[model samples]
Target: MLAAGSGAVPPVVWVPVVAWCVAWQASLQHEVIHGHPTPSVSFNRWIAGPPLALWLSYDRYRATHLQHHVDERLTDPLDDPESFYVTERDWQAAGPVGRLVLWSLNTLVGRLVLGPPWTVVRFALSEARAVWRGDPTRRRDWIRHGVATALVAIVIDLGFGVPLWLYALAVVWPATSLMLLRSFAEHRLAADPAHRSAIVESSGPLAWLFLSNNLHALHHERPGLPWFVLPKIYRANRETVLERNGGYRLSGYAEVARRWLVTPRDHPRHPGRAS
Candidate 1:
């Protein structure tokens, strides 16, 4: 049903609401991938595959994210696909403005304000360049992604009667907000793989929103465990888990917002040495 006052509601409200729902659905996909909601992996993927988050393929993320759990090479710039660190050489190569932009993205506000644009634009440009160069991997990735992109365009154009660009701006901005919150303090490139992931001690409302992924250490340790069961397992092993993570814990997002809203968590130069 079309909401009666939705048309008059500010873009801020609808944008965030759509983004939050999408983010929650993405969390559900993560849960499905971890064998939650069913024993059948393919079935779970089917249900969770529609959203096509950050324009990424769910199967591809599953493969890469599982490798990330290996814990032996937590945030090695090359080995960890999710590393945010720039190599010293790259740091030196950056211009003044480039360096400033990099630093800004290292903070919470920057991640929300600038991260989405940076990520999407960079990826699209790189993909275009790769296509020009005839990169097979890029081709295959895009071929799979193209189908979903077309579907997303059709839904926005036909269903909402909104221009593709407007729909994108509306969806991507607030979706990145949700992503930033989940990932903002999830890790800090520790010396040990076991200690690499951070723990949000009490996520409360956000925990359910993230499908209990706030208990990230537990998820990393046992990815097969269902989302609903994670809280129970975490509670049972809270002391051990905290010790294993080298006391890298936060009260919640409020405390996280208070401490690191504008500050860098650690020096960008700190090598994520395996301990």
Candidate 2:
């Protein structure tokens, strides 16, 4: 916060650093959800509960992500909360502009650039509807999130004197965008459950940014494995893992961009099913 808020701070440098911190926090939260260094779920939640991204609550994230681990429903738009696919009814109801936007979002560049706000808006509307319907669970989740975020707000706004706009633009947006890069082609529709997830073979800082989740298929195969051990696990059974995932592989994000930066990965509508 000081780096971004201090008068001497250079935004060109500090902004990206702040974004990386936010992204790292998100990666840590993913780790916490997966039962990382500790086994206590509540402890992990407390450790990573602050809403750095500002749009999502940790409870909601943990619950939905655990559901996403059900490999059979990996790409079922209605069943998997994380799936980006739309049901046929929703697709049919959408106007031309909405269709275009959905299709554009399937591309890698579009997913990185536009996915964050789209996701936030959709999540907010759904939660709003849930509250309107008097969903006690949703109300409880938001109340807890509000309490946790109060601490975060005090630290960022009052303690550090960092403006909300700066934090949102520099930290939250880019962090969410970084996550979109990992999720852009993480899964797709397939007959085989194992084939649903794709593997992006990457290491170094980018891999660390996602806590080695770029090797997505292996992570899904063994969700209990900690992030640091994923590479060792992948190396131990490289060929088997690749074959299990039906050869859905990419060299890295560079390959993802090269292949799908402009091209839509798949149709937005879920295939072969009624809405």
Candidate 3:
């Protein structure tokens, strides 16, 4: 907060540093949801601190992501809360503009450019509907999320000298986009439950940003293991990991970009249930 607020901070470094912090907080949120640094889930959440992503509800994410770990439900459009695919019924229900938007999101370029806002808007609308329906859980989630995000804004905007708008654009948006890159191809549609998750063999800075989750298949296989140990464990059982995931591996995010930047990574429609 201080670096970006301070006039003396590096011109280029402030944006990325702040952005990395936001993204790191998001990774921390994921870790907290997975029961990290403590046995108490509530304490872990407080330690995870403010909702840096601003648009998301950590409570809601916790509920959904735990559900996402059900391997059999891995990429099921109807079951996986985080599934990128849509059911044939929904696809057929969507009009031309909506279909085009879904098609664009299937590409890495469009995911980077459009995913965050789309996610935020869709999430907000869903939450609004839930609130309207008098869902107490959604009400509490958003209430807490809103207050926490406001606290973050106050600390950055008022306590420090940074503007919320600038922070949202430079830090939050890029942070969200970076997050999308990690998730962009983390899973694939596969018949075998083990093969649904993918492995990205990247040990660089981005891996740290994702808390070593770039070794994704292993993370799914051993979600209880702490992030720091994932690499060591993965190395020890590299061949087994490869075999378990049916060799669904990528060299790195660079390869992901090379393959799917413009090309659609997969149909937005879940092929197994497609019309």
Tens digit of per-residue lDDT, candidate 2, span 168-266: 877788889998898998998899999999999988689989999999999999989999999999989999999999999988988889989999999
TM-score between candidate 2 and the true structure: 0.96
Clashing pairs in 3: none
Question: What C-alpha lDDT values do all the predictions have?
Answer: 0.73, 0.87, 0.87
Which residues of candidate 1, in runs, are more than 4 Å off?
Answer: 1-12, 52-54, 122-138, 270-275
Q: lDDT per residue, candidate 3, 59-172, as tens digits?
A: 888887899999999988878878878889889998899899999898998998898898778768866988999999888888888888889889889887888888888787
Which model is ahead, 1 or 2, in terms of lDDT?
Answer: 2
Global fold similarity of model 1 (TM-score): 0.88
- Residue 185 lDDT (model 1): 84
**How many residue pairs collide in each prediction?**
1, 0, 0
> What lDDT does model 3 reach?
0.87
Worst 10 residues of 1 by lDDT: 1-10
Give the alpha carbon lDDT tens digit for every residue of 1-275 in model 1.
Answer: 03412366666667667777777877887787677798787788778867535465665556556767777776665566556666776666777898888888788888778878876665567557867899887678777778887897676667666566665677766676677678878877766778888778774878988888888887888888888888888889999999998888888888888887898765554353322
Check candidate 1 and list the clashing pairs. 191-275
The candidate scoring highest on TM-score is 2
